[model samples]
Target: MLLDTYGRIATDLRVSLTDRCNLRCTYCMPEEGLQWLGKPDLLTDDEIVRMVRIAVTLLGVKDVRFTGGEPLLRPGVVGIVERCAALEPRPRMSLTTNGIGLARTAAALRDAGLNRVNVSLDTLRPDVFQTLTRRKRHDDVIRGLEAARDAGLTPVKVNTVLMRGINDDEAPELLQWALDHGYELRFIEQMPLDAQHGWQRDDMVTADEILTSLGGRFTLTPEPDAARGHAPAERWLVDGGPARVGVIASVTRPFCRACDRTRLTADGQIRNCLFAREESDLRGPLRDGAGDEEMAELWKKAMWGKKAGSGLDDPVAFQQPERPMSAIGG
Candidate 1:
C-alpha cells in the first residue's frame, strides 16, 4: 500500500472524467456554468485506465470512485466503467453523479460493473430544486434514483448538501424519504469548494444539528464505533432498522485523519486532498510517453507529501481549493 508521510494508507482514488456538468447548483457553480476544457485537454479513456491500473496494481489502491461535473455527461462512460471493472485484482468501483441521466444509464452502467451509486439530491421540493440548480430536471433526477434501485444498485445513496438557510429544513423529510424508499441518506456539511468562494461557516448546518434533528424524528443511534472504521461519513442506524443515514461533517468535523482518497482532475492533475491548493500535473509526462513506473513515482511523490489535515480545523489558516467541486470532481 502507498503510505503517506502521516502513516495513512492511500487506497481510494476518485477520478474526474470531465469538468462539464449538466446542472448549475447554486453552491457548486454559476447558472451559466464555467468554461470547460477543450476535448484535446481532457484525459482519454486509455489514459484514465492507465492511471487506475497504476493506482491499483502499484499503489495497492482498492476502491475507485468516478466523479465529474456529471460523469454521465461523459460519452462512453459505460466503456470507462467497463475498463475499470476489468482491472486485474479489480478494485471496488462506484460513481458519484447528479442522477439527471441515471434513469437511462444506470442499467447499462451496472452491467458495466459499477458497484453502487451516490446521487446528489438536496431537496425533494421541485421548486426548491429549480431554485437551487437553476434547472427543471428534478423529476429526471428522481427517475434516476428509481432507475438506480431497480437496476440493482440497492441501498442507493442520496447525498444531501445542507445549506443553513437553503435546504437544511428538509433534513428530516429527506431522511424519511430515503428510509421509505430504501436509499441511504447522507447529509454533507457544506464546504468552501464553490467557485464563488462565498461559503460561510454560519451558513452551514453542523453535523451536531443534523444528528439532533434526525434524533428528533427517529430513534437514531450512532453506528457502532467498529462500524465506522475508515468510512468518511459517520453513520447511524435509523429506528434500529436495516436502513441508516450518514453525515459527513466536512466543515465542522473534518474526517481528514481517516481520509484515504485522492483525486485526479479531468485535466490530469493529482490532488492529494479535496481542499489541496497545489496540484501535480501528470498530463505533461503522460503525453511525453512516460511509462507506468514513472507515472507511479510522480504519484507517490505527490501523495508522500500529504498533510495531516485539510486545514479546516485551523479556520484562521484554512483556504479553499482553487477549483470548484465540479472541476475537482464531487
Candidate 2:
C-alpha cells in the first residue's frame, strides 16, 4: 500500500474530468467568466483510467470520486464511471456535481456504476440561488436532485457553502429540508481557495454556530470514519430516520491533521495540498511510455513527500496557489 511518512494511506483519489463548467458561481469563478484549461492540457479518458488503476493496485485505493468545474460536462463521464466500476475490487465510486445537467444523466451515471452523488445547492431561494451561482436554473437543480433520488441514488447529498452574510441564515431551513426529503445536507465553511476573489476569515460561519442553531432538538452522533479521507465533512445522523447531516469546517475547524486525500488534476498532476503550488506531473511520463512499475515508484515518492498538515492558518507560510476551485476540482 502507498503509505505516506505521516502514516496516511493514499486510498481515495479525486479526479477532475474538466475545468469547464456551465454555471459561474460567485465564489468559484469570476463574473466575467474565466479561462479554462486547454483540451490537450487535460488528461484523456484512457489516461485517467490508467492513473486510477495505478492508484488502486499500488496505493490500495478503495474509493474514487469524480469532480470538476462540473464533471457532468465531461463528454464520456458515464464511460469513465463504468470503467472505474469494472475494476477488480471495484472501489466505491462517487461524483460531485453542480446538478445543472444531472436531470439528463442521473440514470446513465447510476447505471454506469456511480454509488452516490453530491449536489451543490447553496440556497433554496431563487434570487439567492441566482445570485450565488450566477445562473437562473435553481428549479433545474432542484429537479436534478429529485431525479437523482428517483434514479436510486440513495442518500443524495446536498452541499451548501455557508457564507456568513450570504446564506448562513438559511442553515436551519436547509437542514430541515434535507431531513424532510431524506437528503444528507452538508454545510461547508468557506476557504481561501480563490485568491483573486479575496477570501476573508470573518465571512465564515463556524460549525458550532450551525449546531447551536439546531436548538438541541436532535442528537448529533459523529461518524469517525468520515474524517479518514480528504472528505472535509464531519458526519452526524439525526435522531430519527436515515437522514444524516455533515459539516465541512475547513476554516474554523481544520481536518488537516487526519487528511488522507490526494488529488489528481485532469492533466494528471498529483497534488498533495489543494492550496500548495507544488505538483508532480504524471501525464508527461505516462505519455513518454513509462511502465506501470515505474509509474508506481513515482507515485510512492510523491505520496511519501506529503506534509503533516496544509498549514492554511499560517499567514506567512500559507501562500495561495494560482489555480481556482474550478480548476482544482473541489
Error of 1 at 280 (Å): 0.8
Worst 10 residues of 1 by lDDT: 28-37
Q: Give the TM-score of candidate 1.
A: 0.98
Show model 2 residue runs off by greater than 4 Å. 216-231, 240-242
What would the C-alpha RMSD of candidate 2 be, to one decimal place?
A: 2.0
Error of 2 at 266 (Å): 1.0
lDDT of 2 by residue, 1-330 (tens): 667888887787889999888887877777774777889999999999988888887778898989998999999999999998898888899899989898999999999999899999999899988888788999999999999999988779999887777787887788888888878898887778772658766666778888876645677767668443467788776775356788888766777777777799987888887776788988889999999889888888887888877777675677667888888877
Best-performing candidate as measured by TM-score: 1
Question: After TM-score superposition, what is the CA distance of residue 296 in candidate 2 from its true location, in Å?
Answer: 1.4
Q: What is the C-alpha lDDT of each candidate?
A: 0.90, 0.84
Error of 2 at 172 (Å): 0.6
